[model samples]
Target: MTKDKTGRLHVTVRSGRKRKLSSKLWLERQLNDPYVVRAKREGFRSRAAYKLKEIDDKYKLLKPGMAVVDLGAAPGGWSQIAAAKVGAVDRKGRVVAIDLLEMAEIPGVIFAQLDFLDDEAPEKLRAMLGGGADLVMSDMAANTTGHRKTDQLRIVGLVETAAAFACEVLKPGGAFLAKVFQSGAEAELLAQLKRDFTTIRHVKPAASRQDSSERYLLATGFRGQQRP
Candidate 1:
């Protein structure tokens, strides 16, 4: 680590001989990222917490007593912010997290290690909430295959699935937020959300890397499904 002429500290990865170029660059970025540093200092699980924090701070989507569900919540960074914002600690709210990988326990958060696309996952999450959620959010991303088009499709597909599940499990007037790459492939998903929700928009938090294409798609005021 060395201070630049501007007095900003910089970390350079010197393990190039043992690490692939990609791995070395990623390690150096993680080490120097201000959000990662702050997350460590603040005791959050990961730097992702700031992404959600900045969005919710401006939108005021989270409130005390809101029932929330977090999808793909491994590492539990977003869950930590949601738990505090919704007052989950005192039971003033409920938070249910779903992920294929196991997540350590977090107070006021109900964790179920399962694929959210499983046939029973939606109903199962609703059961855990004892009814419906006021908000459903996901930071899920599909694994990349190194091909840009294929990766874009996977990201959109995952977001589409998460949005569908959110529609099923959220109460009337609820909100949905999920991470999406800035791709035109989401036209169909956006069209569906426009019909199901009263408002839709994209949010990019400062914590997200500036070069990344990621943006959170937010749909609010669900109109509720029709009942026969």
Candidate 2:
């Protein structure tokens, strides 16, 4: 590791015979990433914690005594930020997180190891929340197949599912946030969101890698009911 001009450590990885070039590059990127280093120092589960933090700082999404649901919340980075902002750690707020993968315990979060797409997921999450949610956020991403169009479709599908779930359990003034790609195919999704939300915007936080095509869709002021 060597210090860059910003005084951040940059790691260089050598590709061994057994290591694939892609894997070596990924490892190097992770090691040199400033947010990864900050996450470690700050004790967050993943570098993604900064992404939510930056978004929340600007949007004021999380508030004390609010109920929050985190879809695909493995590793609990977003959960951590929500818990802190909502005072979940003090038992004044509620946070329910669900994912297909088992996540280790997070202090103020209720973790459910299940797929959000399951028919039983929404009811289970509502029970865990004990009431309607004030905000529903998802950082879920589909497994990439290296085909851009296919991956984009999958991502949009995931976002749509998440939005549907949000509509089922969110309060009248609730908000929804989900990760999405920059593909132009999101027009349909945006149209749907506009029908359901009073305001919708696409945001790319600084914490998101500049080179990455990933962006977030934020929909605020839910219509309180789903349209036909």
* Candidate lDDT values, in order: 0.92, 0.91
lDDT of 1 by residue, 1-228 (tens): 898788879999887567898999999899988899999999999999999999999999999999999999999999999999999999999999989899999988999999888888888888898889999999988999999999999999988888888888889999999999998799999998998999999999999999999899999999986211
Error of model 1, residue 226, in angstroms = 8.2
Q: Which ten residues in a row have the lowest lDDT in candidate 1?
A: 219-228
- Give every collision pair in model 1: none
Candidate 1, TM-score vs. the true structure? 0.96
lDDT of 2 by residue, 1-228 (tens): 788888866789997999999999999999888899899999999999999999999999999999999999999999999999999989999999988899999998999999877887777878898878999999989999999899999999989989988998888889999999999889989988998999998999999999999999999999975321
Shift of residue 16 alpha carbon in model 1, Å: 4.1
* Cα error of candidate 1 at position 175, Å: 0.5
